[model samples]
Target chain A: MFRHVVLFTWTEETTDEQKATLAAELAKLPGAIPEIRAFTFGPDAGVNPGNQEFAIVADFDNVEDFLVYRDHPVHQAAIAEHIKPIAASRAAAQFVFQA
Target chain B: MFRHVVLFTWTEETTDEQKATLAAELAKLPGAIPEIRAFTFGPDAGVNPGNQEFAIVADFDNVEDFLVYRDHPVHQAAIAEHIKPIAASRAAAQFVFQA
Candidate 1:
């Protein structure tokens, strides 16, 4: 399986309502992309001692499926219409695994 | 690289000092495992609409290396001595990547 894991930190200045909207947009993608078997996102609990916050974990069946998910039209649309609008900063780790 | 990513959530009743100690314990494993190229951990922002918390993102050269890290004495010792004592709940997603 291939996994695309991203750590997203939205600015603290963001309102709770906005966070809700962002989550909604993320949810829309699973139905929009066939390669995405599982997509999960959540808030940062401020418990760890490091530079991180929200995380998004998306799983694919294989490398091709992952790359497809990465380049899917729905993904591009989501980035252009939703995610990029409010994200303060983001970092990602793409893990390519054979299982 | 093989990545073993885990999300750990400690009880809210847990104290800050104990959390600090847990982070220190996790940090030690990187030095102990030579195959490990990168390791990162942090708190859950609680901004996402999901069931996740603290996250551990560890990268290894290959699946064998990750399995080694998983079985290493230092890792086993940390879980036995530190993590198991304080964690309230935890979930993990292991990603095996070719690149």
Candidate 2:
């Protein structure tokens, strides 16, 4: 499998409503994009101080499948409409692994 | 479950041997600390540019279990001995979700 993980730090101006919207939008992706084998995302639980504010962890069958999800219109729309505006800093890693 | 995701960007001077050592050390944590329910980590696959170099994703039953793994001497030692030396930047997120 190929795993893609992203961490985002929200801008100070970002609102709770926007975050909620992002989550809602993301929750719909797996249904819309069948290439996604597994997906999990949420706001940080604050168990550790000074950590990123949100996370998205996804798994795909291979790099090609991951690319399909990456370029899917629904995913692109979510990123442009909900994620881009509030994102302050973002860090991501994509790697192949066996489940 | 509580999930912890951490990303690391290696320093310019970091070598392959150091990263391998880090991975080897990290692979031992699940055995040493029983609280970890799931763990996956690897160097980035270069699917995207300007992304972090490495990722670690872990799951625990709850916040307390997550904390136990976080503060475990073996984990701390791995961080101190392998991770800290080569890491140029780090970003992490810990969140809760139903598995």
Alpha carbon lDDT of residue B14, candidate 1? 76
Model 2 per-residue lDDT tens digits across residues B1-99: 899999999999999999988989989999999999999999999989998999999999999999999999999999999999999999999998878
* Candidate 2 CAPRI assessment class: high
lDDT of 1 at A41: 69
Q: What would the per-residue lDDT of candidate 2 be over residues A1-99, giving only the tens digit for each residue? A: 999999999999999999999999999999999999999999999878899999999999999999999999999999999999999999999988779
- Global lDDT for candidate 1? 0.69
Which candidate should be chosen as best, given TM-score against the real structure?
2
Per residue, candidate 1 scores C-alpha lDDT tens digits across B1-99 of: 555667666777778887788778888787878888877665544433453456677777766787788789999988887778778866554544444
For candidate 2, what is the lDDT? 0.94
Tens-digit lDDT track for model 1 on A10-82?
A: 6777778877877788878889898897676666544334535566777788767877887888788877776
Show what share of the native A-B interface contacts model 1 retains: 0.00
Chain B TM-score, one value per candidate, order as shown: 0.86, 0.98
